[model samples]
Target: MLWLDLEGAVNVRDVGGIPTDDGEKIARGRLLRSDNLQNLSPTDINFLVENVRLSTVVDLRSPAEVTSEGPAPLTRIDRVLHVNHSLLPEHGFAATAEALLVRRKREEERYPGDPSCAHYLGYVEHRPDSIVAALRAVNRSAGAALVHCAAGKDRTGVVVAFALTVAGARREDIIRDYAATGERLDRILDRLRRSPTYAGSIDSVPEDHHRPRAETMEAFLEQVDKRHGGVLSVLGGNGFTDDEFDALHRKLRR
Candidate 1:
């Protein structure tokens, strides 16, 4: 039943009412997460610009994804900060396989080459930079903001998890927000799988091989705890000062 009003972008949701530290609740409509808005409908774009009142957008996909897919053509908002995460390489034909191979290598080093955990844990360790940047932008924005990557799950999910945890959201609530992607990710994944950019990248792999599974999500969170020492550590290490942390909880939580 959780839904947002963005017209073209799926997986957009507010993080309000989630508990933060000291019994506070994150304010709704101030922070949003979603998949890339490159194909957002006009009505949706209008609504986002006029109604949601967004001040900025933080893009977390790789530089490649931005070049190929571009972004939603519409933004009444003035600023769009594109700090693509390295792990989720830009979506492209040749680059897809290369990115996966790089991930495979990193995973091997981290977990003796378990592909599952490699794909999951690698992002958890490195996403703090992106998360911190997004939060800082949100903190400075006068109105609403949106953060996203290709599917709005992996990179975007970690940022969401960190924000929710720091703001006092229960673990279950955090996971629930992440789990919402299950219902909305299919179309984006399907489009990517069928594209020649994606297909040509994997010679013999089936289309289904490229899509993330539910187990991938579970593995990702497990890796976050295992490697990053939990979300708080990651946040703190990313330069979240104690005073700023308290302010975030206050601003987000009601």
Candidate 2:
């Protein structure tokens, strides 16, 4: 895990240099995963744009969150293309407590064993189109592509996992990368807790709810294999063409 020393973001890292099954390694500095970019400092912005050469930002934040937070600094950059690929519907005027309760109930029902796995599954079940679109945007990027959600743990994790799987990265490496978020859970939660958009929600949640376990991602990948046959099959089922799949693979693998 190559962590980026950004002024605002804590969970940012370059998801490269992992060994693939075919003895090839993922290209360095081409793919990054991070938490929200709303608080990125000017220096952070310049670092990403100039040093990282970030050309595309695949934001998986919901419409409601985006509206509340306003445009991110990267969104204002002329050379960088920001794409919103929300996996869930915008929360209406419902009370926060009610929305959270309903979401928890749905996640519990989705997967009885692990709530994290269920929440990840919901991303695919609820918005297959958005997942496909996000992957397509990643494949289309001319330079480095950064994928982020609010915490860069769940939605971002799933998408990054898919990208790594498609690139033939070792399963152990994938799980290790997913579990790496747990190392920075405290910082991530603190940053999110300071944000008005997530403060109220995260304040009421347990610490474990914010942590990412290797088992959660292991189960998620297993479910994907068992239910959808594999990552490629899931992408194909979700309308990703063969050429797009090939392009994504080529973009990641050296």
Best by lDDT: 2
Predicted model with the maximum TM-score? 2
Q: Give the TM-score of candidate 1.
A: 0.78
Residues 1-254, model 2: lDDT tens digits:
69898997999999988889988889988899999898999999999999999999999988888888898888889999999998775443222756886787888898887888988888877787888999999999999999999989999999999999988899999999999998889999988888888887886667787789999999999988887788888889989999988899999977
Error of 1 at 243 (Å): 2.3
Cα lDDT, model 1, residue 15: 75
* Model 1 deviation from the true structure expressed as Cα RMSD, one decimal place: 3.8
What lDDT does candidate 1 reach at residue 49?
Answer: 69
Candidate 2 displacement at residue 192 in angstroms? 1.0
Give candidate 2 misplaced runs (Cα > 4 Å). Answer: 90-95
